[model samples]
Target: MARQRVPEGPTPPPAVQKLRIRYAKRGRLRFSSTRDFQRALERALRRAAVPMAFSAGFHPHPKISYANAAPTGTASEAEYVEVSVTERVDPERLRAALDEALPDGLDVLEVVEARPGALADRLQASDWVMTFRGMPVADLERAATALLEQERVEVTRMMKSGPRTFDVREAVVSLTASPAEDDTCAILRMVVRHTTPAVRPDDVLSALRAVAALAPPTPPLVTRLAQGPLQTATATVADPLAADQAGDGT
Candidate 1:
């Protein structure tokens, strides 16, 4: 066998700073897959002239890390990504430039210089809101109560490998249903922990159907309201980038 010669070249510059960005997938953009967002972001970085750090390999790619992306077909207000840059950049300036470069539906809400800890470690739980049109609040409340009463609720999801069944009850930190302002629709709010197999909002809905025979007339509009460290006492999600922001003295 003939030996292949290794290509020699100068290595890419080392990353000087890391930044954490909080962005939203709203409107029609929520339906885009993770790969779609990744490509869009890379393009935006290039168009915005961001000083992104590249990997030191033959096919070098930008060093961008995504943490706990929301499922496709669902809107989210708390999507997060971290980027390494070859040159230090002002977080706000970078955010503005990228936001302008990207499409309108994908909004950049905030950015912070990363601290020492990993950003993924802080995303312990997520808060979600599901809106069911033409469904009465009373019915939703009953279903939520039934689901909460259950000791265990299992749901199945089709994975790439095969059908996987998992218990969603343990991951549910809080679940509540109330009437929307219109009174004709119902809103369900839930807090779920980031667990193995990952209990999604759809999984909770499946559990509701199994436990209380709750089925909406129309597809529910699901949106992730928050994703961060869970505040035990308040049963709410705190900002994941707060530590980084504080560290940066911003």
Candidate 2:
């Protein structure tokens, strides 16, 4: 016979304010995965005395939600999360408190009272900057040019379920290679749409290798510069926090 389920305990206090936060994962901390970040966030919340609201259940978890988390081992400047609190708190103060509570390299950059819409709906694309050390900038430029000329660039990756093949070129909104600051480095910047399986920077790199045989000696340093809705005319991504800023009259 199946075991009977236990009933939920009493509901916690209702949330009075919901805040959206923008944070950065920099340096060594970029290696931390989503699961690791979640655990750290809960610890920081408790240490900082954040008045978090809890779901009504026997095992009431904090009402925290994450969106568009960057892949592990990649740094990000525009990661976002939303949290419900039982009491009102100044966004800036909360930012400072949490920033101090968390370890170095996982910094809370900004916070705003959440606006009406879902955060995921605002994240249509991401801007990424990839630095390949010891690679020639001119080679990257040539590869980027060839990539743009192509209608589709198919690449394969192993998924949790199985291996999958997809065209990384279809999701690329913009691609460009920048002049290196130093002789030993090359940097490529790209804006890609969030597709069904989501084309990541590594996938694009795989396509480049396939088409142009451009390969870095070591793993490229990847950093997400921004993430938000794509503006097709300008080929730019609107800041996801714009609506929240307007709501706060900032």
Query: Which number leads on lDDT?
Result: 1
Runs off by more than 4 Å, candidate 1: 1-7, 248-250
Give the per-residue lDDT of model 1 (tens digit) for 1-250. 9998665698889999999999999999989989999999999999999999988767888999999999999999999999999999999999999999989889999989999888888999999999999998888999999998988998999999999999999999999999888677899999999998999999999999999899899999999999999999999999988888778422
Predicted structure with the largest TM-score when compared to the true one: 1
| Candidate 1, residue 194: how far the Cα is off, in Å | 0.5
10 residues in a row with least lDDT, candidate 1: 241-250
TM values, all candidates: 0.96, 0.95
lDDT of 2 by residue, 1-250 (tens): 9998875666689999999999999999999999999999999999999999998756789999999899999999999999999999999999999999998999999999987878888899999999998887888999998899999999989999999999999999999998666666889999999997999999999999988998788899999999998989887888999988887422
RMSD of each: 1.9, 2.2
Question: Each prediction's Cα lDDT score?
Answer: 0.93, 0.92
For all candidates, the clash counts are 0, 0
